[model samples]
Target chain A: MDLDMVKYLAELGKLEFSDEELVKTANEMTDIIDLMDTVKEIDITYDALKDNHNAYLNDLREDVPAPSMETAKVLQNAVNTNNCFVVPKVVEQSLSKGVVIKWTYLQ
Target chain B: MDVSSMTIRDMRTALDERKISATELEGEYIANIKKYDDKLQSYITVTEELAMKQAEQAQKLIDDGKAMPLTGIPMAIKDNICTEGVKTTCASKMLENFVPVYNATVMEKLESQNIIMLGKTSMDEFAMGGSTQTSAFAKTKNPYDLNCVPGGSSGGSAAAVAGGLAPAALGSDTGGSIRQPSAFCGVTGIKPTYSRVSRYGLVAFASSLDQIGPIAKNSYDCAMILNAICGYDPHDGTSAKVNVPDFTEKLGQSVKGVKIALPKEFFGEGIDSEIKSAVLKAADEYKAMGAEIIECEMPSLKYAVPAYYLLACAEAASNLSRYDGIKYGHRTANAGSYEELIIKSRSEGFGDEVKRRILLGNYALSSGYYDAYYRKALALRQLIREEYAAIFEKCDVILTPTTPTVAYTPEMTSDPVQMYQADICTVTVNIAGLPAVSTTCGYNANGMPIGMSVIGKKFDEATVLQVSDAFEQGFTPVMPKL
Candidate 1:
């Protein structure tokens, strides 16, 4: 793993690290990934995947609508306004096109 | 009464015979916690008021002659498990003040039985690390030696039980969390077969691998707790619909003719010679008791650690994604956009170990690396399970060391991979979704505990408990001197 990859993963994981910490994280992740690489030594054969279906498929409960926590209770832990979670702007108008775009940054 | 040495059975007898009131028992435990917790730092939240209230209710039940087996029994809970009004922090800043609106299914069952909750215990942040040192709260010390750490992510539960702060405690195991800590803390703990216990409101770390079980001073206590907590619930979709048995039913049963398999891989390189010999001695003890000991091979054992890390981290990455600033948990005060808010909040909330896992999990599941890492881990997981199934075909149970070595100081290993290697002995049981119990079989030169594991077939906790209880009968567990 390299700094670029670490940065990408951090971005994907919705986390941030300072430049120094990113390098340290990259080194640590490299060691961990090396450990993960040992799984490649497993000689995968067709027999392994033969019965790879969900073993608990029959155990799943019926997907019926059921009573859940009240809206007020559900939102009680959040920063809410009128029972809805309040959040920073997820969309912003593009200055050039005057069209809304998803907000994003690399941190 | 010596609350420090009393098991649930002893407490039950005393509570029922009027030798000690439930309130008195609760007060004794609280006093012990107050006396020793400053040095041990095992608990994150001590629910004294809640315990007193539950003790009062338990006394009323006993007075009315309706006391259940676990009634009036005080126990500690891992912080990961939801307790309706108490903060279930998972020992992370992320959920530091997050209180659940409802209780976990296990909590509900215990509550109905009138069990007293002494408090929430600390653990590795998000149950991500093997050492309790990763907890954002206090680092729980090994009761045997304060310089050493109590093995974790369930370290607090195990420490509390071993320290006599609580008789027994509930712990969740994902890749040796419960058993490792129990072993390190010189107590007994079980990680039941996957889905044998409900996982509803467990604050999912690895959805497929996580299972909640008990840690206690002995196997009988663990069995009693398991009896109350193990059962199907509509709330947890993965909970097995199989019949729940009296886990303590097989206690004192003969181990004669029982086939115990010792996989050669577990005793090989990286294991401490003392731990290996102690576990082998345990097997010999079983042999003397008329049980058949058979040496076996599990080639897939070499891949278990890697595969477990890949699978568990991937699941953790997905599960922990819910901690964004929007819905609940910590939110950053200075973010200009939603994305920035999530990144900042998570960056600020999680500890180093948790962040490392998230990053690694994403790396494993990333678009180009999925097949090489995540998918291969899944295949290896299947292979590992099949290997266990094959061994079980000829064996009643598998015996192995719970950890490669005894508990060590926090400064023992700075390399993360070295720490991961310590779990090599216990992770395979979780990978196979089997029930295994860790009991102290011997002690090291420094008086640190060495644990041996007895793993049973899926949902066969009765036999597992039977074997563990049989071992405990001949062995004496040394308590840490407070």
Candidate 2:
């Protein structure tokens, strides 16, 4: 991996790497990839795209919200309750399983 | 009895015998916190008033012969856990003032035991860094050597315990966060089975791998804290329903005939001589106790770091997307556009290391390269788990150094790879979701501590503690008196 590759990767990862960090990451990736390449020589048969060993892995379903989180309470945590996502909020968990438990146990 | 070094078992005896009051113990710790926390930077918030109130309540209960185990015993927690009404920053500017309205399940468990909470300690921002240097607040110094770092993101928890500021502390382990710092600080730390403790209240840092565990002066104390804090919480979907052992029950049991595997990879070249010797010395002691010792090897051990970074970063990116500065954390005022709002919020909220990880993780989990990096790492993770399961079948526990090296000075290794290498000895357990511990086994000539890791099968904390305690007796090397 070169500096350009590192910079591109950092960008994709959402990281803003410093100029110094760019060099360091490039060097490390170069070293690691070099070693991996050497190791792969014994096992490097380039399988075609879909025909590869892991191509048929299960595709998980997108999680759908089902009666979770109350709107009023959820919005309470929003800094701009007037915004699309803002509203009044309460601490989520009930005290039964929270800070009140000790006192409840004591009582 | 000095509560700082005393295990929970002994502390309980004193409490029950009426030789010590819970109030007195809480006072002692509060005083210690006041005296020692400045240079140490171990705590972000100290709940002295609340702690005292809890202590007083426990004293009343004890007078009424109704006090429970851990009642009024003060313990510090890593700041990532929500503490209802208390600021629960994950050591990030983004949740700096976010007072959680709810208590995390582990906190609830401790509260149910009437455990007095000392306060929340510092951590690597979002529990991202190994040295705690990435915290938005301040770096937590290694209690043993102020110039050096305590291994992190649980550095503050370890420092709190090692500095005698608190009898015990809590830390989270994603990839050796708890155990690594405990090793450097010469404190006993346990990263319990994944889901062994609930994650409901902990600010997420790689959800699948994150586990909340205890840090203390000894394994037995760790077990007691585990007994109090471990159990299923309905709030956490992943909480384990395993039977909670009366952990103290087996503290005195001999570990004779316990089969231990010394993985060849952990002890080979590239290991610091001091760390290697300390681990070997601990193994020798385990041998004297009639435990069976055998050599084991995981050829795929070298792949752990690559796999861990890819997986950890991928999850981190998704988990951190919630902190866009709009909901919680640091935010810039009057950004002209939403894009600017988000950019400014993130840049202002996260530290450099956190931003770097977010980027790395995002890339791995991104659309085009997911199959090449993230999926491969997961596949390799399964291979590693199978290797551990097979190794466990041959041995009762796996032994190795907790970290390849001791605590390094701040910025000792600016190269990320050098820092990542420190975790090589620790990450396989996280990938496998098995229980592991790092206990002070010996010390180097410089008096720096060396920790040897004891890994056990899934939910097999009992055996892990047994072997660690047995080994601890004969491998007794004290901390350099820092």
Candidate 3:
């Protein structure tokens, strides 16, 4: 892994790191990826892969609505108004087209 | 009453005979925590008032002759497990102030049996690291040697139990989190098979690998805790439908004619000579008791660490995506837009190790690399499971060192890959989703504890505990002076 790859990963992961941290993270990620590459030594083919271990398909409960945590209790832990969590505005109106458009500041 | 060395059974007898009141017993433990916790740094939050209130109720239950085995027993809980109205931080700044609205299924069961929870213990942040130094709050010291670490991410729970802050504590193991710490602290711990215990309330680190288990002074005490906590829960989809057996049923049973396998890979390079010899010595002890010892080869063991890290980190990336700074946890104060808010909040809130895993997970799941990393890890996991299955066809249990070496000072693990390599001995048990118990087998030349694991087949915790208890009967555990 290189600095550019680390930066791309950080972007995908929604994280930010300083220049120094980025360099350190690149080196560490390279080492860890090297370690993970040992899995290539396994002799199994991709076509032979099957999900037969540790799967508990039969234990899943019925898909039905049941009693749930009250909205007031669930919202109590966050910044909320009217029992709904609050977040920064992420949409805007395009005045010429009179249509909602993605916020340019998102990236 | 000299409660420092008392097990859960011994405490139960004392409470039943009216030799000590539950309130007084709780007070003694609280006092001990106050005296020793300043240096040990084991507890993140001490629920003294909650413990006393529970103790009073337990006293009433005992007075009414309705006491159960765990009644009035004070124990510490890992901070990762949710307790209603208590801060359930996974030792990270992200959830430092987060409290649960409801109890974990295990906590509800323990409450029904009238056990008092002393406090929440520290852990490695998001259960990511082998050493507890990654925790944002406190650094837990090993009770045996104050300068060394107590293995983590269940470090505080192990230190609390070893340092007498509480008799026993509940810890979650994703990959050796419970047993490794217990080994380093000279205590006993068991990692039940996947789905053996409910995972509804555990702060998700790795969904497929996580299981909650008990760490205590002995295997019998661990079995008692397991009896209360192990059962099917509708809330956890992965919980097994298998019947929960009395784990203590086979404690005194003979190991005659039982075949125990020693995987040759586990004793190969990277393991300390002292740890290997101590584990071999325990195998000899089991042999003397009429059990058969067989040597075996598990070639897939070489690939376990890589597979475990790739799979665990990938799942962790998915599970932790819920913390987008909208619902709960630390939120950045100076963000002008939603995208910036999430980026700044996550970057500021999470520690270094957590960030590394998250990045690694994302990289593994990315388009081009997914086939080479994540998919291959899944295939390797299946192979590892089949290897264990073939071995179990002939052997009843497998014995190996719990960790490669004894606990070391934080300076010894400055390189991250070197630290991950130390988990070679214990990670395969989680990879195979089997049950294993770790107990102190011997001490090193410096008097530090060395632990050996007895691994059994899936859903066979009864046999695992039976073999562990048989070994514990012959070994006398040494504790550090407070």
Clashes counted in candidate 2 amount to: 12
Tens digit of per-residue lDDT, candidate 3, span B1-482: 78989998899999999999899989999999999999999999999999999999999999999999999999999999999999998999999899999899999999999999999999999888877888889889999999999999999999999999999999999899999999999999999999889998999999889999999999999999999999889999889888999999999899999999999999999899999999999999999999999999999888899999999999988888888777888898988778998998899889999999999899889999998999888888888888998999999999999999999999986788898889998888888888999999999999999999999999999999999999999888888886
Q: Model 1 residue B85 lDDT?
A: 94
| Candidate order (DockQ) | 3, 1, 2
Q: Write the per-residue lDDT of candidate 1 for residues B182-252, one digit (tens) a residue.
A: 99999999999999999998999999999999999999999999999988888887888889999888999
**lDDT (Cα, 0-100) at B121 in candidate 3:** 96
- Candidate 1 vs 2: which has more DockQ: 1
What fraction of the reference interface contacts is present in each model, in order? Answer: 0.76, 0.16, 0.76
Residue B286, candidate 3: Cα error in Å is: 0.7
Deviation of model 1 at B230, angstroms: 1.1
Best by DockQ: 3
Q: What are the models' TM-scores?
A: 0.96, 0.87, 0.96
Off by over 4 Å in 1: A45-54, A63-66, A80-82, A93-107
Error of 3 at B267 (Å): 0.6
Better of 1 and 3 by DockQ: 3
Q: Against the true two-chain complex, what DockQ does each candidate achieve?
A: 0.57, 0.12, 0.61
